[model samples]
Target: MSDFSAEETDLMDKHEHILSRRAELLERMEAGRQPPTSHRKQQEKEAEAARHRNESLLQDLQKIEERLKGRRLPAPSLLAMETRYWASLEESIPAWEHFLLGKGPHPADSRGRSPPQRAERRASTAQDRGLPPLPKHRPAR
Candidate 1:
């Protein structure tokens, strides 16, 4: 009987030890199977988005650099042409004023028909712009 009792005690101890080891193994497996933490997942997503944005910005910068590299500087002839255009404008101002005001003697008196024709064309154009007709004159007060 004592031997049988000892055998039963040993079996119970073995059973308990096995259950404890199984519990430890299951705990480790469950821990290993868990997904990444929410914070870590969010950080990874943000990092990926930032990388894409940075790549797009880099591409845009490269395109701008290429455009700058290929750009041509204006030639000296453009400066000369611009200067002539401004001088012509200064020389023609009296005619423009005469056409718009309609009071000054025809600009043709000094420069000839070209000024009057230009003025007449401008006057007609002004009439077509939906603006009020040019006043005839304010009689000298």
Candidate 2:
């Protein structure tokens, strides 16, 4: 029993040490200082390890949350969250795409229509003239 207690205390101490070190790393990362080569390598390794740890922690958290709620989240609930996320994305797509891809606006049609076809349609449409297009094509007599 004494040996077990000593081992448990050692484990707790190690955990506390790790937590403090992680905090220091986070502070230094935020400071944006130019670290020494070895320090930069160590920080990169620590960040990679922390990312993996966080991913597993997130999965555990989600499982615990589901269990505590006493019911599974419905598919619709997940879908609604996804839809809300995408709705928020609608406003920023153009800016985000421009920043990420360094390209101009997306091509209007995925079907590979010629630019002339798009232009001609735009000219022929009544909506382009600020009035509704006539329903049928007819020649003026």
Best candidate per lDDT, number?
1
User: For residues 8-124, what per-residue lDDT tens digits would candidate 2 score against the true structure?
Assistant: 999999999999999999999977676678998999999999999999999999999889899766799898999999997896677667656956544444347877898888877
* Local lDDT at 2 for model 1: 100
What is the Cα-based lDDT of residue 66 in candidate 2?
83
Task: Give the per-residue Cα lDDT of candidate 2 at 60.
Answer: 100
- How close is every model to the real structure, measured as TM-score? 0.37, 0.24
Off by over 4 Å in 1: 39-46, 49-57, 64-141
lDDT of each: 0.88, 0.83
Give the CA lDDT, 0 to 100, for residue 59 in model 2: 100
Clashes of each: 0, 0
In model 2, how many backbone clashes occur?
A: 0
| Residue lDDT tens for model 1, 1-141 | 999999999999999999999999999999778856996799999999999999999999999999999999678899889989999999899787987798676566655656668889998999899889867877897
Cα lDDT, model 2, residue 1: 100
